[model samples]
Structures are given as structure tokens and as C-alpha cells.
Target: MRDPAQDPDESGFGFPAPLWRAVARRRPLGLDVRWRSPLRGPWLTSVLGLVLLVVLPVVTVTGLLSYSAYGPQFDQAYPGDVGFLRLPDFDWPTDPPWLYRLNQGLHVGLGLVVIPVVLAKLWSVIPKLFQWPPARSLAQVLERISLLMLVGGLLFEIVTGVLNIQYDYVFGFSFYTAHYYGAWVFMAGFLVHVPLKLATMVRSLRGTSLREVMRTGRDQTRPETGPSHGLIPTDPDPPTLSRRGALGLVGGGSLLVLVLTAGQTVGGVSRYAAVLMPRGRQPAGTFPVNKTAEAAGISREAVESWRLTLTGGAVEVSLTREQLLALPQHTATLPIACVEGWSTTQTWTGVRLRDLARLAGVTEPSSARVESIQESGLFRAATLQGNQVDHADSMLALRVNGGDLPLDHGYPARIMVPAIPGVHCTKWVGTIDFEAG
Candidate 1:
């Protein structure tokens, strides 16, 4: 069924082999069936894939867990499209106060660490990307589709994640929604690729450990000859670097990137070294502020006359900050972890959430919504599951680090829920509407 022209060049470019070679010799990238990179082979690609197996799962799991910490069941679920997958509807644990901090730190840090490996893996498989005839059969067609998804989805995720952490919004869409959906897309492709390539990866690495491959010197380095994934070039150029040098270059670059940026995740003196992290080199106060009172448009007049309104009670009760302070005050040390990956732990003094619920005549409340005084913004309101509302450490915070909350630190009143995302803590809280079952 193959046409004579299709059999000649097989690139679907319609040019015969001689003409194709003539045209390709003058181009930046050619349709030549083989590449000339001596350091690239199945051995290299498998090495990078193995590294990703260890790193990518941590990033993916923690990233999904970060979203779960927002209490998606209580109207805080972002992206709202609950597609083919939805995280379990359960109360995010509150026992470990530093839960979100550790989870997000690993997510953001490991995410950065995987970049070099991905790049190296892509480089090793460049010849396959330009494979002639595109697909020879249905299986090849399916592999090509999955490969496209794997590469494209991951590239999109990396771009969005990097720009988001830097507070750059050039993407012109909601970072939260787009990144959330994009993660699912990448994961779909990633899942398909792993099973399909697991056997090939294992075969390529059998008896050929990375250390053995890396020990090869420039003089001994030769183009791979085996038909391992069809990546071995037919006409390889002379070696520019040994296999050892290539692996070292990629490994060294990845290690360097991890060391420079991971300091922010651990915090303290190490954080000072993570100058590349925007939040790591933040304010010298108790901790950095996500949004200043000025930015949230908080007015001094409103602060002076601030009243926390408790609704869904026997009687709607409004209390001034001083009056609320008169009630039994409790203190809890909790970490406010942001989705952007920076976290700070501070001791907060405030009225217990259960007490507030009682005041609202909703003892043993099913759920509650905390509304901010900001008037408008995605973060202005957040709904909390009953467990979050009733947690012993959950409070409407009035002070931090034994001092009155600063204007930039959600002064006057803020909700501090154990193990909650920072944004969902609902800074400058003006109202708490309780729901009784």
C-alpha cells in the first residue's frame, strides 16, 4: 500500500534521499535519520528517567497535597472543575502544625531540582524527535502521541511554575487554575510514559550501570552501536567530551541548582544564602508579609473601629478587638505556608475558634466561612470544614510573637487555622458565619 515516493525519503517531505541530504546539509536541524552526538544514547536517557522517578513523584504528591490542605470540601477547592480526578474529600490533618510547610517545601524544592535531568533526557532523545516517516505503525503513532503529551505538558508546567514563584504574571491567566489543570495534563502523560518505557529503560540499563558508563574517557568514548531505542546515530561526530564529562556536567549543574535554591525551603541562616528565592530574602520583621495592609486597601479609620461580627447565632454579636481580647485568649504556634513555597512559623495569641463558634450560637458547628475586610479579592473569603473550625489551635489571631499583629501582618484580626494554606487563613477577618447541623 506504500507509494513509491513515500518509500524513497520516508520523511513525508516528498524529497528523495539525495535531494533531502542536499537540503539538510544547509539547515540548522535536518531530517537526517541519525544524529551525531556521541554522548547521547539510551544509557543516558535511562539515567535521567531513573532520576526523575525519584524526584518527580515527591513534587507531584506534595503539589497535590498542597491543594488538599486548602479544604477543597468546604468551598475552597480551586479551579472548580473537578474533572477526571479529584483529591479525596477529607479534613487535611492538623496534628503536625508544620505539615503544609514541609509538604510545600519539598514540592517546590524538588521541582527545581528536576529541571536539569529533564533537559538532558530531552537532548538524548532529539534524534527520535526528528525520526523519519514519523510513525510506521499504530503502536508508533500512539507512542508519538504520548511522547508529545509528555514533553509538551511538562514544559508548560515548568514554565508556569517558574513564573508563578517569581510573582511574574506574563501568562495572562489565573496561575492557580491554569497550573492546577496543567498538572493533571502533565501527570496523565507522565503516567502513560512510565509504563510504556519501563521495560526499555530496564533493558538499556541492564549490566550497564551509570558509574560504568560515566567512567569512559574521551579517548575510549565511542558512539553507541546497539539498537537501544534507535537513538544510536549512524554517523556520529568525533567525541567533544567523555561520557563521564557529559553526565558530570548535567549532574553538577542539577546539584548546583538544588543547593542554591533549597536553602529557602529549610529557612534560617540557610535561607539567607537562597538569595535567588524572592521570598527567602524577604522583610526583616517577624516574617515576610504576603500582602501589606496598604496593598489590601486597609484604612486606619476602619482599623480603629474594627468589629468582628459573629453571625448564625442566637443573636448576631459584634465585638471590638478589645472586647474579643476580654474573652478567654489562647496561643498557638503554627506555620503559615504559602502555595508559592515560602513558610514562616509564628506564635499567635487569639480567641479560640470554638469560643467564637459558641458566641455565634453555633456550638459544634458543621462548617464556617471567614470573610475578610478587603471587600474584593479571591482571598477575601474562605470556607472551613468543621474540623478546621473546631481545631484546638484554630483561632482568630489578634497578636503575633507576643506583640500586636502588625499592619502588614493582618493586624486587628486574622484567622490562623492549623495546617492551612496561608491565603485561606483569611487575613483581616471581618466576619465568621457559622453553620449548625
Candidate 2:
């Protein structure tokens, strides 16, 4: 005989009865309420957190490096020169041409691996989101807010990253701005959560042997309760997945995802194995283009009439197809590494950009702005640092693989610089302003 106030049903396990009733009544995916899992404990959560602790920093750092490679540093001199960040004037090293490809590949590959780990981590702590008395104190309230930031930021970054890799943009906001700023927020939350959980993680990890805990299927620190004890009622059931089994499943799934998509950027024999790649094998002298010439609203006649213009300082020179061809032509086989995790090498033949600068009467210009004929878009124009302009391989590419440049490949002339992002290598070159300052 229990008092109504003390009854578990009436008190709702420390939560209000109406709240529990609402949660119970909400059917998620129409699954049997009894079949749903209410298993919440610290072992799996701690283990998953440990895995994320190891992997997430790598993902974040590599991603930041890849973004930096796009020459975000130039944004300082010319405000709003690049996308979101008004970054300092820093030049990405151009020595190792393969550096950009390797960093970008790692960023995308590691990002894929994080998917399973994040899912497992989120699933483990989801029960806490519904815990009774949502906030016990000011610290708990702050902790919950940080938790929200961590979860929201991570999901936003991962989802947006995947979409960018797949060239899908369903959202109205710019992916670069959102993903870039979101990373800072995510990391801030991550930094906060790490210290809070570090002591508990260390203690839980130390007190319990992983093998023994997996075998017993219980977190040593938490009291063992029957599966039927929480939110959705469950029948008396044994643990469906052991700790070791869950780890193996997550690891195997992550590995599979890596194998399926990594080859698109890694290239080599793995390219054949990359079954999930969005862009299949491209035609000779042509790689996959995210935006087609037609999609960019460029007509064949417009490209034909296009002329390369060079200005700034004491130099204003416009060169047509024949005039550009007359200049000293140099060829270099360079890889066009896109941020979207796809890269392809092609032999580009064109006049050295420095030669054009020299023709414009501006020697050793600090920076040059390259504008495209593509009417409108985010990357219609890009600024090349002095280092990029001076690079021996940097040129105004007139041809690819010994053939006339294709429309999708920035026909007529495109800025093809070594060790730079594909986007910065502006297409359909129309103007070059040599900024001496």
C-alpha cells in the first residue's frame, strides 16, 4: 500500500505523470513500444566518447587545413575577398603539389569514419535527454546547453559536409560559411564537454575491465536494473548486443563506408573500388564538373567572343585567343583538387601568368585578382597570392591534354595554378587585376 505521491506511476519516476504519458504515447516509426530499447548506462557511452575523443580532433584539424589550403589567408588584404572569414594574409605552401590532395582526402575519409562513431555515441546518451528533472542546478543547466551545442554542431557539420562532397545544396545558406562557423561552435562545445566528462571517463574506464564488462553486459558503476524499468515499457529481455559486438559493428560499418567512398579522392586502384563515388570515370581531357556550362548560362558564342583582360598598376592588356596563343606557351601536368573530395590530373598548356603580369608592366605584384565570365556565383572571382603567381607551373591554361579547353573545363582560358584549390583556379578567365599593395 503506497501513498499516491510516492507511487512510481503517479510520480513518473521523478518526472511528472503527464510528461511520461506524452512521451509514451508518441509513436516513433510505429514500432512496438515494448520492443523499443530503454537501455541507458555509462559503459557504452564512455567507450563511444573515447573513440570520438580520438577521431574528432583529427577530422576537425584536417578539415581546417583543407579550408586553409584554399587561400583563406588572402581575405585580410581584400575584405570579403574569400567566403566567410576575414582571415589573415597567409599563403598555403605550394612546394608539395600533392599536399592539398592528401589533406582533402584525409578530411573526407576521416569524416566518413566519424559517422558510425557519432551515431553510437548519440544513441548511448539519448536517454539522458529525457531524464527526469532536466536540470538539477546551474551547472547542470550549462552542461545541457553545451550538450545541445555539441550534438547540433556535430550533426550540422557532418550532414553539410556529406552534402557538399555529393554536390548537393538543399539549404539556402552558403555551405562554406555555415560549415566553417559551425566547426568553431562545435569545437567550443567539445572543449567544454571534454573536461567535464574526463574525470568520469577516466574513473569508469579504470574501474571496469572492458572484457569483463562486455561479458557481464553491465556498467560496473551503475546499478543493474531490469530492461523494463524506463520510458517505454519492455519485456524482461537479455542484452541484444554485447559491448564488444557493438564496437565491432561500428568499426566494420565505418570501414565499409571508408572503402566505398575514399577512392574518389585517393585515386589509384582504389578508384575502381569506390562504388559510392558520385562522379564516375570522366572522359579524356575532361573531368567531372559540378556546374555545367549550360547550367551556368554561358552560350558557345559568348565563350568564343571572350578575351582575357589584364589590368592594375601601369598594365591594361586584353588578349584574344590568337594573341594568347602567340605568347610563350608552357605545359604542366597538375591535379585539380576540388574541396568536394574529387581530383583529376590533366596536362594544361598556356602562357605563364607572370608573363601576362610582365606584359601588363607590373613586375612582382603582391596579389592578382582573377575574374571569370560566368555571370554570377560565389566563386566567379578569386585572388591569387604572389607565391601562386610566381609558381613556375601557374599559367592561363588555354588547352587541356593537348586539346582545346572544353566548355565545362573553363573554355578559352582558365587560371590553372599549381597546389591551389580547384575553385580558386577560376574558370573562363576574363580579367586579371594585379594588385601591387
Candidate 3:
């Protein structure tokens, strides 16, 4: 009997015989080469799938929470709000101010860790990208489309997220909008792809043990059993890496990446261990700053002349720094958590915003628009919700960590509302325009 590997027509299986014969005759850039390694099969794909299935949801939830931290209640209030889903007024819970810090740290940390798994998963089934007669049926066509969406969406999101973390913007589109919408797109694809591959993944995982999988170098089933099995040519290549070795390398790399970058968010020992953090080590001061006063173009003269202005229904008051200091002082230890995933707690001292509201004649301010002296930027001004303004810890902070606030730490004054994102903690605060209830 002739060898099936040398007979394209006989071995083509579900694919068109003519296409297979043509492919066999051509040696164009080795694109027709199929991966026959047991490592590049459903077994490995299932392993990677299990890992991703666990991590992706964590990423998605944290991402949504970060977006929500931008004051979803003020979604329509700001022209730059990127959240498409105008979720109802929901203040990210503030009781444990470190809540945002924990969530964002997990988001960034887990995101970096998932990189190796995603790459390994893609490598495991890359042959499917070049399969003969790409779509044999309607189901196959839909599966291909869903896979395309999943792959493309994940790549887009991961790239954009990394870029944002490094403060790099190579794309023309808004990173916020693209990333926000891309998450949903990726999730939609993920939801569809999971169920479609569930049966295959279960079978692949249950088919063999780790040792057997590495040793056999092929599925346990015979080639005649299924089209996929027949696609593997009889010429078996020697294994370059064992199953355990491959998994170990990927997991180790992911853990290394996590250890190197997680310090930016994970405080204490991990913070020091994250030597590769893009922001560098936390700068000396009350805490690290994403933006500096100089970088924001606020002059010393502006700081000297800065006065806290308050206006709302039947209330208008402008208080000098001395006057603000004289108003009943309050202090709160709060964490400054940025969207980029770094956070540090500071002992903030200043007058409560509610007191300022009352000083301006409104006993109970529903909302307050905190404006910065910086003149321009996305977060130069932020709307403080009623709950945030009324929170006991809410205040316009002046001193930090028992000393005068550093210039980079929002000198003179800045908003310090609990359970809010760092960006919303408007720095260089110059005005507090309370909204009428």
C-alpha cells in the first residue's frame, strides 16, 4: 500500500482534493506546512483556555470599575466621558478607600500575567489560520468569524492598555473610547467562542495525562477516527519540549512579568520588587504624582493668587488660603489611586468640602464642581457627587503626610473625596461650584 502522506488526494479528508494536491505540489514560503506537534493541539489549547477563562473576567470587571470610577453619574455632564454605557449614578464604594487601589492593581497585574498564556494559546492552534478550504460549512464560517473577533479584540485591548500605561499614544483614535468599546467587543467574542469550543476542550483535556500527552506526541485517537486526526501526517517529529516544560516556561514568564510590574500597584514588598515599573519608584513626597504642577503649567504667581471660589443656589464665596486654613480644619488618610494602576495613601489635612458648602451658605450641597487652576486638561475639573461631598472624609486637602502639600501633590489645595479615582480628585483646585439640589 502507498503511504498516505505522499498521496494528497487520498489524505485530503474534508478539504477539497484539488486544493490539497495543489498545496502539496507547491512549496511557497512554507505556508502550507502544518503543525503536527502534540504541543500545538487541543490539549494545550484547553490548558491555555482554562487559564484565560479565569483571568479575562477579572480584567473585564476591574476595567468596568475603573471606568465607573470616572463618575458614571456625571456621564452626560462631561463632554469627554468615554463610557458608552451610561450606567446610573454609582459611586465606587469608598469606606475602605483602598478599594479602587486593590481593584486596579489586580487589573494591571492580571493583565500582564495573561500575556504568556494568550500567546501560548495562539501558538497552539495557529495551523487553523491556514487550514485548507477555510470554511467547510456555515457553522465553520461562524466559528472563524467569532475567532477572528476574539483574537483581534484581545490584541487591540492589550496593546492599547499597555500603551496607556506607558502614556504612549500611537493611534489617532481616543484610547479611552477604543479601549472601552473594544472590551465589550472582546467579551462578546469570548462569550461566543467559549461555548463553541467547550466540547472539544473537555474532550482534549480528558483525553490524556500530562506525561502521556508529551510522550505520545499525538492524540490518543486513531487517524481514521476524525478529519482532525487525519490532518496530522504520519511523519512524527521529535519533541523539542515536554508538556510540563512548556507550561512551566509560560507560567514562570508570566509570574516574572507580574513580579516586575505589579509593584506600581501592589504596595509593600511587591512595590519594591516591581523594579520594571514604568513609573519608576514612587517619588519622595506625600505620594507619587502622575502629573506635576510644572508639567501642568501652573505658575507660582497663580498659586499665590489662588483662592477657593464657591457658588451655587443662593451662595457665593471666595476665600483666600488663610481664610480656608481658618475654616474648621479636618484631616483624613486617603489613598490616591490613579487609573494607570498606582496608588499610595496620604494623611490629607484641609477644610471639609461640606463645611465649605455651608460656609458658602448651603447647609447641604447636592453636588460640587471642583475646578483646577491648570486652565486646561481632561481632569482639570471634576464633579463631586452628593454622596462623595457628604462623606465624612471628603475635604479640600492642603497639607499631606503632616507637611505642606508638595507642588506635584496638588499644592495649595486639591479635592480629596473618598472612594473616587485619583483623576477625579481634582488637583490645583481653585473653585467649588456646588450644584443646586
Output the number of the TM-score-best candidate. Answer: 1
Indicate the TM-score of model 3: 0.86
* Backbone clash count for every predicted candidate, in the order shown: 1, 0, 0
Shift in Å, residue 50, candidate 1: 1.1
Off by over 4 Å in 3: 1-29, 76-89, 209-234, 284-286
User: Residue-wise lDDT of candidate 2 within 1-437, one digit each (tens)?
Assistant: 22222234443433355654565566456243333342345556677889899989888887777766766655522123444443344578776876777777777778887799899888766655665455433445677899888999999999999988876898768787788878878988998888777765665566557877556543322332322123222342455665566777888989888888877886767777777677545555467675677877777999877788889856478889899999899999888887777777779999998998888878888889998998998788898889888888899999998899888888888998877777888888899998765
Writing each residue's lDDT as its tens digit, candidate 3 over 202-317 gives: 77677756665456432343221223422334454656766666788899989888878877876666678877676547676445688988889886777987787888847578
Candidate 1 per-residue C-alpha lDDT over 1-437 given as tens digits, one digit per residue, 9 for 90 to 100: 22222254444433244554555455545565557787777777887888887788788889888878876666576877565466776778876878888898888877877888889988898887776555554445666787777888888888999898888999899987888888887888899888777766777788376677767789898876554566777778899898888888988988887777777667767777777888667686568778888888997777888899999888999999999889999998888888877787789999999999998899889889889999778788998888888899999999998999987888799999988788988888999999995
Alpha-carbon runs more than 4 Å astray in model 2: 1-41, 71-89, 208-236, 281-285, 313-315
Q: Report the alpha-carbon TM-score of model 1 versus the true structure.
A: 0.89
Give residue 17's lDDT in candidate 1 (0 to 100): 49
| Ranking 1 against 2 by lDDT, winner | 1
lDDT of 2 at 318: 84
Q: Cα lDDT of all candidates, in order? A: 0.80, 0.74, 0.75
Whole-model lDDT, model 2: 0.74
- For model 1 the local lDDT of residue 51 reads 89
